[model samples]
Structure formats: structure tokens, C-alpha cells
Target: MPDAHPHPEPSPAHPRPEPFLARTAPEALHDLRARLRATRWPDAPEDAGWSLGTDLAYLRELVTYWAEEFDWPAQEAALARLPRFRVPVGGLGIHYVHARAVAPTGPVLPLVLSHGWPDSFWRYSKVVPLLTDPGAHGADPADAFDVVVPDMPGYGYSDRPTGAPLDSIAVAGLWAELMDVLGYERFGAAGGDVGSHVSRYLALDHPDRVVAVHRTDAGVPRFFGDPAELAPEEHAWLEGGAAWGAAEGAYAAMHRTKPQTAAFGLTDSPAGLAAWIVEKLRSWSDCGGDIERSYTKDEILTNVTLYWLTETIGSSMRMYHANAAIAPAQLSRRVEVPSGFSIFPGDLVRPPRAWLHRVANAVRVTEPERGGHFAPFEEPELYARELRAFFRPYRAAAAS
Candidate 1:
């Protein structure tokens, strides 16, 4: 089996990416604790619960655990267990976790897992082993993948893009360069939320380079085809999405408009950062209003701390501004590559199959019984299964 895409001239050898270890300085950890301990309480209607925003009682409880109980060193060490590295790509030092699989026999496809907002590479932390060592987890050894999970700029250990903005389209181009740097002329792409959008663009912008793409949710454009002529079920899906937007889309608007204003408090106050990020983690998760049902306190704090320690809340929020600038034509571009979708029961928007077909050349679609927007983290086993089944067909094409 040979590579499907035209191979790049084996150019001047690429530099080895420097190994990276995720360790917050002791002083930074101490400062984070101080800020959490000193957080000022905010009042809310006694019975509003989460109707308003982040619940006051929940925030207080979460903050207290973050200040007194969370162990940053332990979490950092757990993260370090992955093979992480930082290399200069797209004019910035990019951090990523790379783990190659020694499969049983067949060709091993390289996989690039992209993560969404409110998360870094951590979202795929659970999925990496499943893809790279499926047999160890009781899955087929033939489904092994050489996994690469990059920390999107400003989201984690990656460099902040404060100098300029980047939309999903631009990130797609950058990803192609990163894949080439890693000696992968072609690779599979998969993601959820913002990551799903990035995967869509990667397939759209670099169809020849992307062998197949899997997404937990359909990256269907907002205005797909026309509203005047849609199937009854499609019409209902669109209206439900619209209703959800009117009710739950304010935060996206804020991220697009006044992220700087929100970033000040989030960057300055650890609690502020937790409240902003944790709200989404809870609301969007399948936890049914109780955040504890989905994520542990340490899991929540670890993600928020990544933003706090790096002081990248500003740049992360600015991604919304950048994406908002993507031209409508580009947004509506058809994804010509083989596409797969895993529709989780509790996902933010479960677009009908018809809607998905309108956007992508969808070859596989499944609705898992569990999970939500954070599918990879919430249901790693199911997420891995989705990828395995979706890409199984392309094995020969991808391998050769």
C-alpha cells in the first residue's frame, strides 16, 4: 500500500519537536490558590438555580474545593504521562501529544484529534490510548492509529495568538503544515464542537491531504441550503436550533463581541474564569443540570487552571471573533472528503441525517445512547468505537 496523496519532496529534514512536560510553577499554583481563597461571593436569586448563569452555591462549593483540595502536581503528572512535545509550526511554538501505535498487521493511519473551546488537548486524553492501543482496551488491534493531539493556539501549552487572529479555515491550513512536519502526507481528522468545525475545514481546505474525517457532531452551517424548502423534520431541527440559540446562544455572542471585557475578570480572578468556563461544561454536558454527574472537581479545575496559568482566556475568546469573520461562502463550502458523524444523545444540536448529508459526504452516522458535547471526554469508549468503524472502510485507500 502506498500513500494516496502526492508526497512532498523529502525536503530538508525537519527538526525534532522538543519534548514538553506540563508543570505549573509552584509559585503559580500558590497564587491560584490565593485567588480562589480570596474570591468574592456573588449573589443570585435564591431559587434561580442555574437559570441565570453559573449557580452561586455551586460556584462557591467548586471554588472552595479548588482552593483547598485540588492537587495541581498530581494532575500535571497525569498529563505528563502522554508523549507531549512543542515544535515551531505556523510561526508559533505549538504543543501536542504524539503517540504512535504498533498495530497487529494492517497499515496504521495517522490521526489528528482536535479539541474545542473550554478544553485543550485534555479532552482527547482519554481517547488517545483507545485509538493508539485499541487491543489493550479489548478492541481490535487492527484499528490502531498514530495519534496526534495539538493544543490549539492559546488554549493550553500552545503559544497564544494575541498578535493576530485565526479562524477555523486558517487553522486547517496550519494543521496541514503540522501534519507535513510530522511526516504524515495524509491523515484522518476528528473533533467535537470547535474541533469539529476545524476538522470540517481541514477536509474542505485539504481534501487530498485528509483521508477521512470523523466528528461527534455535524458541523452543519447555520444557514444550510434554504429555509423556504426543507423537509418537515429538517424544518423542526432548524427551528429547535434557532430556539436554542435565542435561549442559550448569548454566550457565543459575548465571545464574538466583548471577549476583552469578560477576559479582564476571567484573567484576573481564578473564580471568574471557573464560573465562565464551568457554566458551559455543565449546561452543555449530559449531566442534566448537575455538573458533578459528568465531571469531577479536579477535572473541572484542571481545565480552568490551564487557562488561568497561561493567561490565555483573552486569546481563546478572540477565536470567536476570528471565526465570525469567515466569509459565508467559505462557511458553506461542501466537505468533499469522506465524512463520519457520531450523534450523541445529549449533544448540543442533533441535526437530522438529512441536514448532515446537506453539509458533508457523510458515509457513516451513529447516535450513541450516551454522552454530550464533550463526547470524547464523556464517553471515550464510544467515541473510539465511532472512529474505528468510520475509518475502517477507508483503510485500503488510506494505507495505499
Candidate 2:
């Protein structure tokens, strides 16, 4: 007789049969628009400028557009053009996109791409196509590989963890498990902002599995024992950066202390959500004082809509509080994996080679002449080239 249990039907040979569609129910958008129209404005001091906070007039205009002209269905259709998948890992339902190369002999080294705060997996949409289909982007066919982009737990379609200690370390573990489940024993990783921090933790904790790691703005803050130990330039950078943080990072502070309270405003009104998020994209990017030049208004709204539609703004921000409670000695145990850094000009603190070497392999560091915190989105070609170069050595070794 044939084996009692024949091999289970092989999973669809193609990992992702269809790209992710927004799938936001029509009622949800109607309710969101209703909430936006019903928002109650708060009074501010006379002569209060953006220095005091987000401009009320600008926010109102944006809200007006969101209600009247913004097209979520159109954006939804655009997203559906790319392949997406969901895999169960660590008892959580993780949503990700897996795009494969066209060439039959293309390398199959898996790559897990992570996104950071004030952004979602959507941030990687532009670069994902380039990485998976290099030939289509005018790059060598040999450069192509399989790409995986996951919406972190409590973000997008992924199931939210209630009162879960879902910090960077925990998330990194989940990524490793996801790779293993997908049959990738070893893989490369890349991220920016909070994504960068998680990528570092992933490489550090699972050095053997992570063949190589790359980050755009790896959020490694300056460490000074005392004021006297700081170099002049380091001190100047710290002071200026601190001043900017104090003036602008109220959201971080709130997220640290009372994320639940802040979530009320974000969840209650779409206009409030727009102000909270759009400001960061404007201030943090290399926009040269023009937000439109860096990102389209539709791009900004799409990011915000992902958060609003999923109702994950609160759980996502809770990560800051969870991490803040951990000590530095515990945070910087030194990752022993090959690492690459792309220091964009607009990062909060641009670390010198010496500083990054202390924590990671620091094999590749590029001070790109252009781009900012959102490097992948603002300069996709530069980002793709740097990533390919950093991982080339490892890719060659794996192939051999």
C-alpha cells in the first residue's frame, strides 16, 4: 500500500499568490471620515507658531482633503499589485510580502526587511520591487533574490499583542522564527530607524542565522561617561540634537510615559492623526524645508491610514516604553555579526566609524551625499546599491 499519509499537498509553489490589498471595509472609511468631520479644535495661545506646535490651519486643510478628495481604494488597488503573505510564528499571525526573482538561476538567500515607527511595512514598497526584480530595475539579473517584508506585531494586518512585552528583542526572535518556518536557515536583514535597532538585535542575538545586516539610521545614541570625556564635535552634536529632541520629540516622551493617553487623540480623530504623523515625515526627512519635495501628500496619508485602519498606533508606540525600561549595559552587549551602516545626513546622530565598530562588525559605512532618515524611500537606487555591495561578500560565500 502507498504510505498511510501521503506527503501533505505541497504549499502553493509560489509563496505569495497575491499582493496585500488594504481590505479596509467600506464602513471603516465612512466612520473615519465622520470622525474627521466631527473633530473639535483646541485653542492655542495668541502668536503661537509651529515652534509652539503643529499649525492648526494646515491640519484643518489636510483633514478637509482627507475627507473630500483622498482615495484609499485607489491606493489599495496599487498595493494589491505586489505579492503578500501571512505566516504563523511565535503564536502570532504575521503578515508579510514575499517577492521572488524572475531568473531561474537567481540566488535564493532570503532577506527580511523591517520598518520603524511613524511608518509601516508600506515604507519598503518602493525598494522591495528593486531588490526582488533587479533586472526590471536595470540591474544585473544575478543581483536578484527573494525578499520578505513583515508588518511588525501590532502593526498592519498582524495580530496585536495585548499587554505583550513586544519589544525589539522579542520582535527579532519572531523574525528569525519566521525565516526558519519559511525554510530559510540563514538570511540577510536591513532596516531604518526603529527597524534598524531591531535589525541590530536580530543579528546580535542570532549571529549564526543572520548572514549579514544593514541599517540606514541605526539609532545608536552617543555614550558619554561625563561631560569632560566628550569630544568637542561629539558634544556639539549631542547638544544640538538634544535641543531638537526637546522641542520636537514630545511624541516620544508621551509614548514613553503615557502611550495610552496619546492614543486616544490618535484613534479618535483622523485630523489629529495626520498632524501627529505628517510633522515627523516633514521634520525628519531631507526635505530642505519642503515636505512635498521629499514625499507626496498621498504617501503621508497612506502611512497614517494604515495605522488608523488597523487601530495599532497605541500598541506600536508602546515599544518605546518597553525599551526605555531596559538598562544600557543590557542594551549594548556587542553584536558579533557582519554589519553595514548607511549614515544618512538627516539622522538624529551620525556616528563616526569608531563608534559603530564598538557595537557591530562595521564592515561597510557610507555617508551618502543625499537622502535623510527615510533613505529607502527618498533615494531607492542609492539604498539598493549600498545594500547589494554590503551583502555581496556574504552572498558569494553562501553560493560557494
Candidate 3:
């Protein structure tokens, strides 16, 4: 038989590498608190619920706590523990934490983990230790992996490029290059939300390199078909979700159409930042009536502060605009790679097994007892267990 495989080359224009620096220290938290305490809050009609969108009174209260009680230094110290590095890929400086397992053995499978909007590399901090050092979590040391978590372009420590389109597909190509640079000839990929879309593209476009792919949210069915041709259940799922999203996705629409205009308030006022992000945590998470139970006040503030300090509010939102221009048909190209899907209860759309089976080689489908959009942070144990089981077969196959 003829050789059916060939390695790919890196893109000519590489992303510029930028130094990773901590913008806020423990002392800065004090200054932020002072600003929050002095905030002149906005007025709202009495009895306004979330329908009015982040009641000013409620936000003021959160910000007051954030300013007075949240510890930035503690969060920074935790992040500093990770071994982070910056690399240039596709004209954007990418920051990633590359944690290798301590096991004395041959190369382990390289896994590139990606994060979505309203999140940062911090989302995976909890999962990284588990994946890279499974023994520490009371799992087999052989289950250890070389974990790579990158802050998507225009997010976190990565440099946001101007006049360049950085959609999910393009970002996938960048991941391929980053993997190549790190000397990983083959690896697995996993992500949720926007990360899911990018991971799909990586597996599809570079099937030879991506041994397996995992995603928390599947792509919208419309990306895979004409509504008229979709199965009745699929149509209902998409339409119902679209209607709800349209009604509730004011943030998405605003971000897609005019991110810069919206960035002003979020970047300037810490209160505005909390109101915008806190609502999503509350509404989208499976926290059993209290978001703080799933996520600490410090956790939420750390993510927000990453955006505010880096001034990435506008750039991160630009992803929505970039993706909007890509046709659904284009986004739906079949990903011919082994895939895994975890359908958490609170996901925007819980795809039926039949629907996902049509898209990729879905080997594992998990119905978590709890958790939502932020799987890694919200339910680390469940997320870690599902990942281990999903990749166990693949890891065994590779060994054989």
C-alpha cells in the first residue's frame, strides 16, 4: 500500500512571543477595594429581577465584597505555582502552562486543553494537577499526561492582534503549530464551548496528529445541516435554543456587533466587570441556587481581573464577530477523528447520542450527575473521571 500519511509544516508568519507578567500584586487589591468602596452606583426601579440585567444594587454589593474581602495575592500565588511559558504561533503570542508528569518513562501523550470566553487559563488550573499527576489524585500514575493549556488568542496573557482575523478554525491551526514546536508528533485535544469548536477543527484538519478529541459542548446542529433536512428533534433543539439564546444573549449580540463600545465600561469599572461576568456564572452554572458554592468569590474575581488588567475585554469579544462571519455549512465539515462528548446537564444544548454519532467517532458519552458550562472548575472530579475513561481506550490502543 502507498504511504497515506505525511507531516505538516508550520505557518510562515509565527506569533510574536511576549513576556508573561503579573500586572496586579497583593497591594493592588487594596487599591481596587478602595475604588470599589467609593463607587457611585446606578439607580434602578424597585423589584427589578435579572430580567433588567444585573441589578445595580446587587452588583454594588458584590463589588463591595470583592474590594473589601477578595484576595488577589492569594490567587496570584496559586497561579504562580504552575510552570508557564510563552510561544509565538500565527502572529500572536500564546501563553500556556506545560506541566509534565514525574513518571520515569517514555514520552506521554501530549494533550492540548483550550478555554472559552468568560474564562481564562485559570479554568483548567484545577484539572491540570489531576491530569499531570494522577497519583496525587489517587489515580494510577500511568494515567499521567503532559498537559498543555493555552489562553486562546486575544484572551488572558496572549497578545491580541490587530487587523487579523482569529476565528476558531485559524486558532486550531495555531494549536497544531504549537504542538509541533513542542515536538509532539501526535496528541489529544479537549475543550468546551468555543474551545469545543476549535478542537473539532484541529481533529478534522490534522487528523494524523490528533489521536482523539473531546468536547463539553457539541456544535450547533445548524452547522451540520439545513433546518428543513434536520431530524424533527434536532430542529426543535436548535430552534428552541436559538429562541432562548436570542432572548437571553444580549451580551453575545453586543459583543458580536460592537465589542469595543461595550468594553469601555467593563474595562474601566470593576463593578461593571463583576456584573457582566457574575450574571453568567449565576445563570449558566449548576451551582444548586448559589454560584458561590461552585465558584469562590475570589475565583470569579480572578477571571475578571485577568480581563481587566490585560485590557482584553474588546479583543476577547471580537471572537464572536469573527465566528459570526463563517457560514454554518463551513463550520459543520465532518471531523473524521475519534471523539468524546460529555453532556453536562446545564449545557446550552444536550445533544442526543444519535446526533453526535453522526459528527465524529464518539467513543464515550457521559451524562454527569451535576455541573454546567465550566466543567473543569465546577465539577473537577466528574470531569477528570470522564476524561480518564474516555481516553483510556485510546491510551491502551496506543500502547499496544
- Highest TM-score: which candidate? 1
TM-score of 1: 0.95
lDDT of 1 at 313: 86
* Best by the lDDT measure: 1
Over the stretch 73-165, how does candidate 2's per-residue lDDT look in tens digits?
Answer: 998878777788776678778888877655523454568899988887788888888887777888776776678889898887787887654
- Candidate 3 regions exceeding 4 Å error are 1-31, 104-107, 223-228, 396-400
Per-residue lDDT over 238-316 for candidate 3, one digit per residue giving the tens place of the 0 to 100 score: 7777886777788989977888898888877777777888888777788765777888778888888887777787888
**lDDT, residue 51, model 1:** 88
Clashes of each: 1, 1, 4
Q: For candidate 2, give the lDDT of residue 313.
A: 88
lDDT of 2 at 96: 86
| lDDT, candidate 1, 331-373, per-residue tens | 7777879999999988887899888887889888899988999
lDDT of 3: 0.79
Segments of candidate 2 deviating more than 4 angstroms: 1-21, 43-49, 104-106, 220-241
Q: On lDDT, who's better, 2 or 3?
A: 3
The positional error of residue 223 in candidate 2, measured at the CA in angstroms, is 2.7
Candidate lDDT (C-alpha), each: 0.85, 0.78, 0.79
Candidate 3 weakest ten by summed lDDT = 3-12
* 1 versus 3: better lDDT goes to: 1
